[model samples]
Target: MDFYGIDTAPIVGVEPTDLPVIDVNDSRMDFVFLLEDDSYLHIEFQTTFKISDLERFKLYDAALYDQKKRRIYTYVVYGADINEAEEFLDHGSIQYRAHAIYMKGYDGDVIFDRLAKKIHNRETLTDEEQLQLIFLPLMHTKKEREELATDVVELAHQIEDENQRFRLIGATVGIGDKFLADSYIKKCWRC
Candidate 1:
């Protein structure tokens, strides 16, 4: 999981197992990105509003400060609209940053109508966030005799060779997805 120059260990479960649970009243951080500069970024994926979000971030920051002796930047990426999340932190000591990602773009009628039908109809992970799951199908689906022949054709066009492409696409898709794989293929093509 490389972000910029930092190689982050892939975040697995959301549950905070090792970290001590301090009372923040509401906010909960999902993952942490620790950098070489001794600064850490705490990321929280929120789906709902919590009154104690800012306070919790402060508490979490202080706790991390006490343990790691490093600066912590608290951030939240909410799956829903930001209004509720914003209202909870009007004035607070913990300066927090928030971002919103639309989870229902393709699943909902709004953005889906804007794209070409073919783009929308392709087999995709139901949740856009579940893009990581695409690797499983790309690998096994091509090998399975039961899968639609058209999928194999599409995969062949997108990737060259059968056996080699199957393995390469499988490995890359798990970590980077088809977009990255396509980019790499294009770079090689240009060369």
Candidate 2:
């Protein structure tokens, strides 16, 4: 939660559920967690702004509610390029809303440098730092988004823990799909 700067009750648990409730649907919800508060948290990563994005999420949340009959909190995490977002949609009696987190204020170059220094000194990366690495591509950067992403992938390769290294590298590649060129990611992903 802190990585995205979420301020809520201290989390005690996160259990994964079968979120793909619609078996034949092509649309997918990015991440959902059954939080400690007995409510569900539905999260989506958006690199661009579109009113339709909220519409799609509304449908997904409705489907999820139908399946689980639980309270759902939706949050849209916007990438660096998006400074503002539409947070609410009113459709007659039904109103849909999503909490927004903007990454425009964060500097990717500075985050990378700080994390790189830790790795250079052979320091174990905390879980927060690991998540920061996974999100490095989504932050503002001096270099092109693709370059910063690939560079983080290379830096992740140096992590001492094999499991941690592989997990974070794969996440970087997966998240990079939102903006980075497919060809560029394919070329640098080999590292």
lDDT of 1 at 134: 23
RMSD of each: 13.3, 2.8
Task: Give a tens-digit lDDT track for model 1, residues 138-186.
Answer: 2212133113222322342343334544543343332232223455545
The positional error of residue 56 in candidate 1, measured at the CA in angstroms, is 1.6
TM-score of each: 0.40, 0.85
lDDT of each: 0.41, 0.82
